[model samples]
Target: MSDEEKRVLLNNAWCRDADASFAFGYALRADKFGIVIEGKCAKCGCAIVRCSY
Candidate 1:
């Protein structure tokens, strides 16, 4: 990994895709009562997949 990547990792700012992070979507809650998204790729949807060897 590069020094910049290392710095970001150390700071817990690492993300898989910067563009995808901006991609927003909405879905009904389990109770189907109301919306839950705050207009960002976060909450229970924001995820970062990493592989370790």
Candidate 2:
């Protein structure tokens, strides 16, 4: 996926989590392999999700 698309997806995901009052933070990284996302729940500072496309 393109960088822009990855960014939009990450933003949407984080917003959804926030709307639910589930504190979270996410990072979108792109490289030769592909797009990858690493997310953490701020409530407990634990890794909650990871996605690649």
Candidate 3:
């Protein structure tokens, strides 16, 4: 993904266990509703998926 898009996605990211990490890149994929960005949390390492329309 583009740097700007990555920045925007991470800006709105959240994790159930803790604050999400600012990683290098996310696993991007397509979904029925929108684009899905997957990553891990900084504190707890839980899976985090953010969907962008």
Top candidate on TM-score is 3
Regions of candidate 3 where Cα sits further than 4 Å from its true position: 22-25
Report every candidate's CA lDDT. 0.35, 0.53, 0.75
TM-score of each: 0.23, 0.37, 0.69
Candidate 2 regions off by >4 Å?
1-23, 42-44
Question: Who is ahead in TM-score, 2 or 3?
Answer: 3
lDDT string, candidate 3, 1-53, tens digits: 68898778777888766765645456878789888888777667778788899
lDDT at residue 4 of model 2 (Cα atoms):
84
**Weakest lDDT window of 10 consecutive positions for candidate 1:** 22-31
Predictions: Cα RMSD each? 13.2, 5.1, 2.1
Model 2: per-residue Cα lDDT over 1-53, one tens digit each: 67787556655443234332124446666766666666665555555444455
Name the better of 2 and 3 by lDDT: 3
Best by lDDT: 3
Tens-place lDDT per residue, model 1, 1-53, is 56665334333423444534322343212235432222234333455432222
What TM-score does model 1 achieve against the real structure?
0.23
